[model samples]
Target: MFKIGELAELAGVSKRTIDYYTQLGLLEPVRSETNYRYYPEESIERLRLIDALKKQHLTLEEIKERLQIIQNQPDAADEIVDKIEHLQEEMKHIQEELLELKPLLKQLNEQQIKLMTKPLAQQGYTLLHTLAILLGGDPFIN
Candidate 1:
Protein backbone atom coordinates (compact mmCIF):
# COMPACT_ATOMS: atom_id res chain seq x y z
CA MET A 1 0.00 0.00 0.00
CA PHE A 2 1.11 3.56 -0.64
CA LYS A 3 0.08 6.92 0.67
CA ILE A 4 -1.59 9.30 -1.78
CA GLY A 5 1.57 11.36 -2.17
CA GLU A 6 3.67 8.24 -2.79
CA LEU A 7 1.24 6.93 -5.36
CA ALA A 8 1.12 10.30 -7.11
CA GLU A 9 4.94 10.38 -7.34
CA LEU A 10 5.11 6.80 -8.53
CA ALA A 11 2.38 7.35 -11.11
CA GLY A 12 3.83 10.68 -12.28
CA VAL A 13 0.59 12.45 -11.41
CA SER A 14 -0.38 15.07 -8.89
CA LYS A 15 -1.92 14.21 -5.53
CA ARG A 16 -4.85 16.40 -6.49
CA THR A 17 -5.35 14.37 -9.64
CA ILE A 18 -5.62 11.19 -7.62
CA ASP A 19 -8.00 12.89 -5.23
CA TYR A 20 -10.10 14.10 -8.12
CA TYR A 21 -10.17 10.64 -9.66
CA THR A 22 -11.23 9.22 -6.36
CA GLN A 23 -14.00 11.78 -6.13
CA LEU A 24 -15.06 10.92 -9.67
CA GLY A 25 -15.17 7.20 -8.81
CA LEU A 26 -12.31 6.51 -11.20
CA LEU A 27 -9.99 5.44 -8.39
CA GLU A 28 -10.70 3.73 -5.11
CA PRO A 29 -8.41 4.03 -2.15
CA VAL A 30 -8.59 2.33 1.22
CA ARG A 31 -8.96 4.31 4.37
CA SER A 32 -6.59 3.53 7.24
CA GLU A 33 -7.33 3.56 10.95
CA THR A 34 -5.88 7.06 10.97
CA ASN A 35 -8.42 8.08 8.31
CA TYR A 36 -5.76 8.48 5.67
CA ARG A 37 -6.26 7.14 2.20
CA TYR A 38 -3.80 4.56 0.87
CA TYR A 39 -3.63 3.16 -2.60
CA PRO A 40 -2.58 -0.27 -3.69
CA GLU A 41 0.44 -0.85 -5.92
CA GLU A 42 -1.85 -1.54 -8.86
CA SER A 43 -2.98 2.08 -8.75
CA ILE A 44 0.19 3.04 -10.58
CA GLU A 45 -0.79 0.94 -13.59
CA ARG A 46 -4.37 2.24 -13.36
CA LEU A 47 -3.16 5.84 -13.44
CA ARG A 48 -0.92 5.09 -16.39
CA LEU A 49 -3.85 3.56 -18.26
CA ILE A 50 -5.95 6.61 -17.49
CA ASP A 51 -3.20 8.87 -18.76
CA ALA A 52 -2.85 6.81 -21.94
CA LEU A 53 -6.60 6.94 -22.57
CA LYS A 54 -6.54 10.71 -22.08
CA LYS A 55 -3.77 10.96 -24.66
CA GLN A 56 -6.06 9.05 -27.04
CA HIS A 57 -8.60 11.87 -26.53
CA LEU A 58 -11.05 9.92 -24.45
CA THR A 59 -13.34 11.94 -22.22
CA LEU A 60 -13.40 11.03 -18.54
CA GLU A 61 -16.83 9.47 -18.89
CA GLU A 62 -15.74 7.52 -21.94
CA ILE A 63 -12.65 6.30 -20.16
CA LYS A 64 -14.74 5.21 -17.19
CA GLU A 65 -17.15 3.33 -19.43
CA ARG A 66 -14.29 1.65 -21.25
CA LEU A 67 -12.63 0.71 -18.00
CA GLN A 68 -15.87 -0.73 -16.66
CA ILE A 69 -16.31 -2.81 -19.79
CA ILE A 70 -12.75 -4.07 -19.55
CA GLN A 71 -13.28 -4.94 -15.91
CA ASN A 72 -16.40 -6.89 -16.73
CA GLN A 73 -14.53 -8.95 -19.30
CA PRO A 74 -13.01 -12.02 -17.70
CA ASP A 75 -10.00 -12.20 -20.05
CA ALA A 76 -9.22 -8.51 -20.25
CA ALA A 77 -6.58 -8.59 -17.52
CA ASP A 78 -4.82 -11.54 -19.07
CA GLU A 79 -4.93 -9.91 -22.51
CA ILE A 80 -3.47 -6.71 -21.14
CA VAL A 81 -0.68 -8.62 -19.41
CA ASP A 82 0.13 -10.46 -22.62
CA LYS A 83 0.23 -7.24 -24.60
CA ILE A 84 2.50 -5.59 -22.04
CA GLU A 85 4.89 -8.53 -22.19
CA HIS A 86 4.92 -8.43 -25.98
CA LEU A 87 5.66 -4.70 -25.93
CA GLN A 88 8.53 -5.27 -23.50
CA GLU A 89 10.00 -7.88 -25.81
CA GLU A 90 9.70 -5.52 -28.76
CA MET A 91 11.39 -2.76 -26.79
CA LYS A 92 14.25 -5.10 -25.99
CA HIS A 93 14.60 -5.92 -29.66
CA ILE A 94 14.56 -2.23 -30.56
CA GLN A 95 17.26 -1.58 -27.97
CA GLU A 96 19.47 -4.26 -29.51
CA GLU A 97 18.89 -2.84 -32.98
CA LEU A 98 19.84 0.64 -31.77
CA LEU A 99 23.01 -0.77 -30.18
CA GLU A 100 23.97 -2.43 -33.44
CA LEU A 101 23.35 0.79 -35.36
CA LYS A 102 25.36 2.96 -32.90
CA PRO A 103 28.64 2.78 -34.82
CA LEU A 104 26.96 3.38 -38.18
CA LEU A 105 24.92 6.24 -36.76
CA LYS A 106 28.08 7.90 -35.42
CA GLN A 107 29.78 7.65 -38.80
CA LEU A 108 26.87 9.16 -40.72
CA ASN A 109 27.07 12.84 -41.74
CA GLU A 110 24.06 15.16 -41.34
CA GLN A 111 23.01 14.69 -44.98
CA GLN A 112 23.50 10.96 -44.76
CA ILE A 113 21.42 10.84 -41.58
CA LYS A 114 18.66 12.85 -43.25
CA LEU A 115 18.80 10.59 -46.31
CA MET A 116 18.58 7.48 -44.14
CA THR A 117 15.64 8.80 -42.12
CA LYS A 118 13.73 10.54 -44.90
CA PRO A 119 12.07 7.37 -46.16
CA LEU A 120 10.92 6.40 -42.70
CA ALA A 121 9.76 9.94 -42.02
CA GLN A 122 7.73 9.92 -45.22
CA GLN A 123 6.15 6.70 -44.02
CA GLY A 124 5.14 8.41 -40.75
CA TYR A 125 7.70 6.48 -38.76
CA THR A 126 9.93 9.19 -37.43
CA LEU A 127 11.65 9.34 -34.01
CA LEU A 128 8.33 10.39 -32.43
CA HIS A 129 6.65 7.30 -33.86
CA THR A 130 9.40 5.13 -32.44
CA LEU A 131 9.07 6.79 -29.06
CA ALA A 132 5.27 6.50 -29.04
CA ILE A 133 5.50 2.78 -29.85
CA LEU A 134 8.13 2.28 -27.16
CA LEU A 135 5.96 4.10 -24.65
CA GLY A 136 2.88 1.96 -25.46
CA GLY A 137 1.15 4.92 -27.09
CA ASP A 138 -0.71 4.98 -30.41
CA PRO A 139 1.91 6.18 -32.89
CA PHE A 140 -0.65 7.26 -35.47
CA ILE A 141 -2.53 9.53 -33.08
CA ASN A 142 -0.69 12.61 -34.25
Candidate 2:
Protein backbone atom coordinates (compact mmCIF):
# COMPACT_ATOMS: atom_id res chain seq x y z
CA MET A 1 0.00 0.00 0.00
CA PHE A 2 1.18 3.51 -0.78
CA LYS A 3 0.26 6.86 0.66
CA ILE A 4 -1.33 9.41 -1.61
CA GLY A 5 1.93 11.19 -2.34
CA GLU A 6 3.73 7.90 -2.87
CA LEU A 7 1.05 6.76 -5.31
CA ALA A 8 1.20 10.06 -7.10
CA GLU A 9 4.96 9.75 -7.47
CA LEU A 10 4.81 6.18 -8.73
CA ALA A 11 1.94 7.01 -11.09
CA GLY A 12 3.63 10.18 -12.29
CA VAL A 13 0.66 12.31 -11.34
CA SER A 14 0.10 14.97 -8.71
CA LYS A 15 -1.36 14.20 -5.29
CA ARG A 16 -4.22 16.49 -6.14
CA THR A 17 -4.87 14.56 -9.32
CA ILE A 18 -5.05 11.31 -7.42
CA ASP A 19 -7.33 12.93 -4.93
CA TYR A 20 -9.53 14.18 -7.72
CA TYR A 21 -9.62 10.77 -9.34
CA THR A 22 -10.48 9.19 -6.03
CA GLN A 23 -13.29 11.66 -5.54
CA LEU A 24 -14.53 10.94 -9.06
CA GLY A 25 -14.61 7.20 -8.24
CA LEU A 26 -11.76 6.48 -10.62
CA LEU A 27 -9.44 5.37 -7.85
CA GLU A 28 -10.24 3.82 -4.52
CA PRO A 29 -7.88 4.44 -1.67
CA VAL A 30 -7.99 2.59 1.58
CA ARG A 31 -8.19 4.73 4.66
CA SER A 32 -5.74 3.79 7.32
CA GLU A 33 -6.51 4.05 11.03
CA THR A 34 -4.38 7.17 11.23
CA ASN A 35 -6.65 8.77 8.59
CA TYR A 36 -4.24 8.56 5.70
CA ARG A 37 -5.26 7.16 2.32
CA TYR A 38 -3.29 4.33 0.90
CA TYR A 39 -3.52 3.09 -2.67
CA PRO A 40 -2.81 -0.41 -3.79
CA GLU A 41 -0.11 -1.35 -6.28
CA GLU A 42 -2.80 -1.75 -8.92
CA SER A 43 -3.41 1.98 -8.88
CA ILE A 44 -0.26 2.53 -10.94
CA GLU A 45 -1.60 0.56 -13.85
CA ARG A 46 -5.01 2.14 -13.41
CA LEU A 47 -3.42 5.55 -13.74
CA ARG A 48 -1.63 4.43 -16.88
CA LEU A 49 -4.91 3.20 -18.37
CA ILE A 50 -6.55 6.51 -17.56
CA ASP A 51 -3.68 8.37 -19.21
CA ALA A 52 -3.83 6.25 -22.34
CA LEU A 53 -7.59 6.68 -22.69
CA LYS A 54 -7.27 10.43 -22.14
CA LYS A 55 -4.70 10.55 -24.96
CA GLN A 56 -7.32 9.00 -27.25
CA HIS A 57 -9.57 12.03 -26.70
CA LEU A 58 -12.11 10.35 -24.45
CA THR A 59 -13.78 12.60 -21.93
CA LEU A 60 -13.30 11.94 -18.23
CA GLU A 61 -16.91 10.82 -18.06
CA GLU A 62 -16.38 8.38 -20.89
CA ILE A 63 -13.26 7.05 -19.21
CA LYS A 64 -15.20 6.59 -15.98
CA GLU A 65 -17.94 4.74 -17.84
CA ARG A 66 -15.42 2.45 -19.51
CA LEU A 67 -13.71 1.82 -16.20
CA GLN A 68 -17.05 1.02 -14.57
CA ILE A 69 -17.85 -1.47 -17.29
CA ILE A 70 -14.53 -3.20 -16.85
CA GLN A 71 -14.76 -3.27 -13.05
CA ASN A 72 -18.35 -4.46 -13.09
CA GLN A 73 -17.50 -7.59 -15.00
CA PRO A 74 -17.63 -10.66 -12.73
CA ASP A 75 -14.54 -12.37 -14.05
CA ALA A 76 -10.92 -11.44 -14.64
CA ALA A 77 -11.30 -7.68 -14.32
CA ASP A 78 -7.56 -7.06 -14.35
CA GLU A 79 -7.08 -9.24 -17.39
CA ILE A 80 -9.96 -7.56 -19.17
CA VAL A 81 -8.69 -4.08 -18.35
CA ASP A 82 -5.23 -5.06 -19.58
CA LYS A 83 -6.67 -6.32 -22.85
CA ILE A 84 -8.77 -3.19 -23.30
CA GLU A 85 -5.75 -0.96 -22.66
CA HIS A 86 -3.87 -2.97 -25.24
CA LEU A 87 -6.76 -2.65 -27.69
CA GLN A 88 -6.88 1.10 -27.17
CA GLU A 89 -3.14 1.39 -27.80
CA GLU A 90 -3.54 -0.63 -30.99
CA MET A 91 -6.51 1.49 -32.06
CA LYS A 92 -4.47 4.66 -31.58
CA HIS A 93 -1.96 3.38 -34.11
CA ILE A 94 -4.70 2.32 -36.48
CA GLN A 95 -6.39 5.69 -36.07
CA GLU A 96 -3.17 7.42 -37.09
CA GLU A 97 -2.86 5.24 -40.18
CA LEU A 98 -6.49 5.88 -41.06
CA LEU A 99 -5.95 9.62 -40.70
CA GLU A 100 -3.11 9.36 -43.18
CA LEU A 101 -5.56 7.74 -45.57
CA LYS A 102 -8.40 10.15 -44.82
CA PRO A 103 -7.39 12.62 -47.54
CA LEU A 104 -7.38 9.91 -50.18
CA LEU A 105 -10.65 8.56 -48.81
CA LYS A 106 -12.33 11.96 -48.98
CA GLN A 107 -11.40 12.17 -52.66
CA LEU A 108 -13.61 9.15 -53.37
CA ASN A 109 -17.26 9.84 -54.21
CA GLU A 110 -20.14 7.75 -52.85
CA GLN A 111 -19.93 5.06 -55.50
CA GLN A 112 -16.16 4.79 -55.25
CA ILE A 113 -16.30 4.59 -51.47
CA LYS A 114 -18.99 1.94 -51.67
CA LEU A 115 -16.91 -0.10 -54.07
CA MET A 116 -13.97 0.15 -51.73
CA THR A 117 -15.95 -0.83 -48.63
CA LYS A 118 -18.15 -3.50 -50.16
CA PRO A 119 -15.57 -6.22 -49.66
CA LEU A 120 -14.86 -5.02 -46.12
CA ALA A 121 -18.59 -4.85 -45.38
CA GLN A 122 -19.01 -8.31 -46.86
CA GLN A 123 -16.46 -9.70 -44.49
CA GLY A 124 -18.75 -8.79 -41.57
CA TYR A 125 -21.05 -6.00 -40.44
CA THR A 126 -19.97 -6.70 -36.88
CA LEU A 127 -16.37 -6.10 -37.84
CA LEU A 128 -17.20 -2.67 -39.21
CA HIS A 129 -19.22 -1.75 -36.15
CA THR A 130 -16.49 -2.95 -33.83
CA LEU A 131 -13.87 -1.01 -35.73
CA ALA A 132 -16.01 2.11 -35.70
CA ILE A 133 -16.55 1.95 -31.96
CA LEU A 134 -12.92 1.20 -31.23
CA LEU A 135 -11.83 4.04 -33.46
CA GLY A 136 -14.37 6.38 -31.83
CA GLY A 137 -16.01 7.15 -35.16
CA ASP A 138 -19.55 7.45 -36.41
CA PRO A 139 -20.69 4.06 -37.66
CA PHE A 140 -23.02 5.72 -40.17
CA ILE A 141 -21.01 8.76 -41.20
CA ASN A 142 -22.45 10.73 -44.10
Strongest candidate by lDDT: 2
Taking all chains together, the TM-score of candidate 1 against the true structure is 0.55
Local distance difference test, candidate 2 = 0.82
Task: Specify the poorest-scoring 10-residue window by lDDT in model 1.
Answer: 74-83
Q: Which candidate leads the pack in TM-score?
A: 2
TM-score of each: 0.55, 0.62
Q: What are the C-alpha RMSDs, in order, of all predicted structures?
A: 6.8, 5.1
Per-model CA lDDT versus the true structure:
0.77, 0.82
Candidate 2: regions farther than 4 A off: 74-129, 135-138
lDDT of 2 by residue, 22-70 (tens): 9999999999998889999878878887887787678888898888876
Total backbone clashes of candidate 2, pairs 3 or more residues apart or in separate chains: 0
Model 1 local distance difference test score:
0.77
Task: Assess the local accuracy of residue 101 in candidate 1 as a C-alpha lDDT between 0 and 100.
Answer: 79
